[model samples]
Target: MSSTLQLVGMGVLAIIALWVLLQLVGIVFSIVSTIVSFLVSLLLLAIIAVLVYFAFTALT
Candidate 1:
């Protein structure tokens, strides 16, 4: 009976550990995606600024 209880406890612990690991992975993925999106936005803004500057100079 004790052995059966021990087995059940171990299985529960394993499941909890897996859940925590998946949560951590999800958090990391979100952080990475956010950073990538920010960088892309910055790059696009810079390109637009440069184009506007060129257009203004051409007009002048």
Candidate 2:
């Protein structure tokens, strides 16, 4: 009976550990995704600035 209880406890602990690991991975991915999105936005703005500069030069 004790052995059965131990096995159940171990199984539950393993599940909890896996759940925590998955949560951590999700958080890391969220952070990386945000950073990538910000970088892409900045790149787009830079491109627009360059185009505007060229347009101004051509006009002058």
Candidate 3:
């Protein structure tokens, strides 16, 4: 009986650990995705600015 209780306790602990690990993984992925998106946006804006600058120069 004691052994059965111990097994149940261990199972519960394992489940809790798995849940926490999954949450952490999700947060990390979200942060990485946000950073990547931000960088891409900044790069696109810079490219657009450069094009605009060249266009004005060509027109002048």
Residue 28 lDDT in model 1? 100
Give candidate 1 regions above 4 Å deviation: none
Q: Which consecutive 10 residues in model 1 have the weakest lDDT in total?
A: 1-10
lDDT of 1: 1.00
Off by over 4 Å in 3: none
Candidate 2, position 49, lDDT: 100
* CA shift of 33, model 3, Å: 1.3
Evaluate model 2: give its lDDT. Answer: 1.00
**Each model's lDDT:** 1.00, 1.00, 1.00
Per-residue lDDT of 49 in model 1: 100
lDDT of 3 at 37: 100
Instruction: Give one digit per residue, the lDDT tens place, for model 1 in 1-60.
Output: 999999999999999999999999999999999999999999999999999999999999
Error of 3 at 15 (Å): 0.5
Model 3, span 1-60: residue lDDT tens: 999999999999999999999999999999999999999999999999999999999999
Output candidate 3 Cα RMSD: 1.0
Clashing pairs in 3: none
